[model samples]
Target: MKHLSILVPDDRSGPNTVACIAGTYHAFTEANKYYGTLGRKPVFKMELVGLSKRSELVNGMLMIQPQASISTIRKTDLIIIPALGGEFLEKNFVDEKVSAWLRGQYKKGAEIACMCTGAYMLAATDLLNGKSCSVHWKSAESFHQLFPEVQLKIEKLITDEEGIYTNGGGYSFLNLLIYLIGKYYDRQTAVYCSKVLQVEIDRQTQSDFAIFSGQKKHGDDMIRKAQEYMEHNYDRKISVDELSKELAFGRRTFDRRFIKATGNTPAEYLQRLKIESAKKALESTPKTVNEIMYEVGYSDAKAFREVFRKITGISPLAYKNKYNREAAELLFMNDAN
Candidate 1:
């Protein structure tokens, strides 16, 4: 049986923290039971490992007592890091013991999986330096600032490279658990777990769910001004030359500053801003695709649809059908009429 060590971080304390830990444990244990029904031995010998025997989180609301301490586990087949709660601050939150333990486990041939902002903890070990990771889109800016070497694939729901795996933000960790079940067990087992847990399997991207809020935390005054201008005037055609001249900056300098601050070029930023606006209109208004396109300053139908697909991984009508509840109801009433 594979020994799975689910690390209960000493510093993490919150409802989210509790959910991930309990949820992961439940999923794996349930998978084991499913295996037993098929006349097979349990696949994983799972245990909660920590720096200490017991730890209280969220102001003592949740107390966790680990089955094994970090020093006690000389070898493990897998390490699962649950999502951390709260803001990922600039303060040094890297636990040396945990980091060392992770590295030792990896060297000892253990695969690592980090759920949501647990990627932050994995990145601290420097194992994810050159690896691609999927984090919550909301934390993308902060994660970029902290771990620039790690390639952040915000649109992806899961990232698996080498022995390290990562999942995107929120309750999407359930998807990762399902994925791991498919990998470690059989596909039939994974499907069974999904149905039992009420989670959809094979969800590959979080793009459609991502809300594009421009990254402006880089502290460049001119770039901030440019971002505000683009956001305020996203409903009209925006020329890069006009922004440059207005800021009295040369084209190259303007581009550099904008990219440095926002992690997107001037054009990409504008496109995202327009798409975000378009998404809002699609969700709330009974607007046609062309109407939303024109409302967001796009005159070309084909160009707008292409860009929408490129950014959001879905077409305009599909997005509306999925999100526009009022429009759907109205259409139903019209059909009745």
Candidate 2:
């Protein structure tokens, strides 16, 4: 079993990206608990280090210090990066010491795992020169514009032969962690972790074709406007006719364009948005499911439950109950394992 050391860049983006790293650590711990019934112990140890705030060591159960000198990090077997921000590429240099140390670690035969825009840090290291990598689609163009030497593949994720692993975005990050856990443990372990986390992940990585569907670029201007409209009107029962008129397109054209851009009908996409909103409400608000259904524009409780189940594979009540049960189970299992 290899011990893993995940390093989170201390810049502005660290807070948002650290969730993925934390999620990975939690998944590993939980997977070991439920699926390690075969008598074999779990095969990994995870350590976290933050590079933001100050040069102080904040000791905790899952958190490590931020003041680690680059030389002191050489003992780590695998170095994982959550995400690096534009500050790494800003006109004025920042974290040069940490950057140089990371380059040294790479040269020392350490495996480097990068999530989302964290690929930018590896690109700066120049070791990714000939290796193919993937970044968030939103940042893909800017990445290429800055570093032309590295080969950028338009996939959900890319794990190269040279031990450099990069993923497209945060969702891709969770997928990659599951992949890693499955590799070290087993499929059952990965599946259990995914179930515990309430994510459906059966793919090894994000496919290139995932970025495009139905012959649409997904970034088309009209499609963006339609999506923006749907987002702003999440609480309203949006009609295709109203959307078409608002976007100044005919009904047929609007439907075709929306489907082409998002690979889903406007109604379907809006429903997904509403369901996602409902999920947030379930997690954060004290409202009943009926209230939430009406708040998210679903007038019928049965229809709302059906849609939520179809999207998330669990009914709303079951989803909430399962979350609480699985979380408690994980805690006990963690102690037992």
Maximum-lDDT candidate: 1
Ten-residue stretch with the least lDDT total in model 1: 85-94
lDDT of 1 by residue, 176-197 (tens): 9999999999999999999999
TM-scores for every candidate against the unseen true structure? 0.94, 0.54
- Candidate 2 lDDT tens digits, 3-53: 677775555354446576667678778877775676777676666654453
- Please report, in order, the local distance difference test score of every candidate based on alpha carbons: 0.91, 0.68
- The local lDDT score (0 to 100) that residue 255 gets in candidate 1 is 96
Q: In model 2, what are the clashing residue pairs, if there are any? A: 10-52, 156-206
Show the colliding residue pairs in model 1: none
Local error of candidate 1 at residue 170 (angstroms): 1.3
TM-score, structure 1 vs. true: 0.94
Candidate 1 yields a Cα-based lDDT of 0.91
